[model samples]
Target: MFKTKWFSGGFSGGFSGKLSGKLSGKLSGKLSGKLSGAALAGLLTAAGAAQAASVSFVQPTDGATVSNPVHVVFALDGMKVAPAGTMMDGTGHHHLLVDGKPLAKGEVIPANDKSLHFGKGQTETDLTLPPGDHTLTLQFGDGAHRSYGPELSKTITVHVK
Candidate 1:
């Protein structure tokens, strides 16, 4: 990692890792999508924190209001989605933590209703929840279902009417 950075080191220090990741992801996303106006603004406004991987909501966007059986979508950047037990670098699966918090790195995401695992590499689902305010966390996990840490996750709020 250090040697690779030294070669493409745009800026120096630890900041380079974060800056490069963010800049690369942004540039690639922009060049591929070619978005403009509000759409570009929306992409810029999306909350992302992963240095090498990012998992976030694609549908029912953050702070969206909706009904039960919400149309949920998952988006990933800088990483590839694979089925559980694949055990490959830069690859993992998504997990929807409904009304749950982000798990620590290497921590096993519990098996329960709140923690919905997408071991088959699912990117979207129709989530049925009670009518009320809820917090949704999009988490990524390795083949063993161990979390990739908070940086690889995103949390959003939704109001069910």
Candidate 2:
């Protein structure tokens, strides 16, 4: 679970599925119209594709206890990492937040304890934090450091013990 000042509601939506060892199972007992397997597969594919891109932390999971000089990494899914020294659509850089407060959209994330910038496509870094529990977040942005969106950002809690 994650807590963020940027969002009001917590993450709640979820889906689960169970599959048994079966070569074939009866899917439809009675149907008026005929349905093709390809059509069903297409619908599922469309739904999956609509999930959209999101950014997350590749290291330092939630509630992690660590020492000083923390190495941080950011992970991107459904999007590509922008090349160093290149800025374009659907790509950019990563930002690190240490006990950070929310900044306005399109604000350039400063290279400080509160806001960190990785505009050169550098996804990992070492940080020094006071020994305590701190909220860490990875926010991806465009060329100008503008946030891609809240959905694209990942937040986690870590304890620097």
Candidate 3:
């Protein structure tokens, strides 16, 4: 016999060894294998077209001038911000796309100095940029870090003072 813990969905129970393999397969399929490659790309594209989710910067208004160490704030609608690796429907984390275009559908957002990943579900951060005009983008990604594309992103321009 084995014990199970379920969250985010209405699933709760304990089962014996006889059901382990079947349950494992089903859960694994749902979590990872259900959609992939081109199919996943198509699904992501369709979801973007169908849904009206959006992310926006709350602190620095577009075209505004600011000082160094800019404070960035993120706002989201039509979805919830969940930590990375949490595969719940209609939930995802944030990524900061600095002066960069959104990642293609089904493309994983890279974790680097330029492409910032807030896998911890952070809604705000402070960034130090060179004294000049720069564009900051708030991009949302799914549990697996797959980009939600431009449809779920917002970009703003700010000038450092």
Candidate 4:
């Protein structure tokens, strides 16, 4: 069982300073094997892609049904978030995918066209989606909007009504 909690506290000029992220839960030996299996699956999913920062939604579950103006939370592992021009290697911002294919590795993901980029290390946001089913994915990109790579993203499904 993997349990997690998210809270917001300090922000410098609308950019998140630190995230009070907490993870609790026990992974049985069997569960550990499962995690490794899942990791392998992800690697297989992106057979040939650039390295992108991995992200996950802390507020909503995949295929969750919710109202518009949804709150989305982003999480990144093995990277740091910085300004657009100050991004460092293995660190970057988050991009919200509305309904599109996964971005190619190293390809610069545009902030426009249903894509949302948080280059200032923003951790949360309220999004208003039109009533419909949408695929939500978090792609962490460098200062240049290039994907951290193919293995660092989290994809989920959400329905707005």
* Candidate with best TM-score: 1
lDDT to native, each model: 0.72, 0.61, 0.70, 0.63
Rank by lDDT (best first): 1, 3, 4, 2
TM for every model, in the order presented, reads 0.69, 0.63, 0.68, 0.65
Q: Clashing residue pairs, candidate 3?
A: none
Judged by lDDT against the true structure, how good is candidate 4? 0.63
Name the TM-score of candidate 4: 0.65
Error of 1 at 71 (Å): 0.7
Residue runs of model 2 more than 4 Å from their true location after superposition: 1-50, 83-85, 102-104
lDDT of 2 by residue, 30-137 (tens): 321455543433333454523366777767888788876776766776555663355655567777777775455676667654787665567677787777788887
lDDT string, candidate 4, 1-161, tens digits: 11122224222221122222221123332344666533533443344322333567887899899886688887664355666676444456777777766677898887675787776667777777778888888887778889765576788889888
Compared with the true structure, what per-residue lDDT tens digits does model 1 show for residues 1-161? 00000111121111112335666676667665676433433443453433455777878888899976688877787666777898966678888888889999999988687888878777777777788889999999989999999999999999988
- Sorted by TM-score (best first), the order is 1, 3, 4, 2
Winner by TM-score between candidate 3 and candidate 2: 3
**Candidate 1 lDDT:** 0.72
Report clash pairs, candidate 2.
none
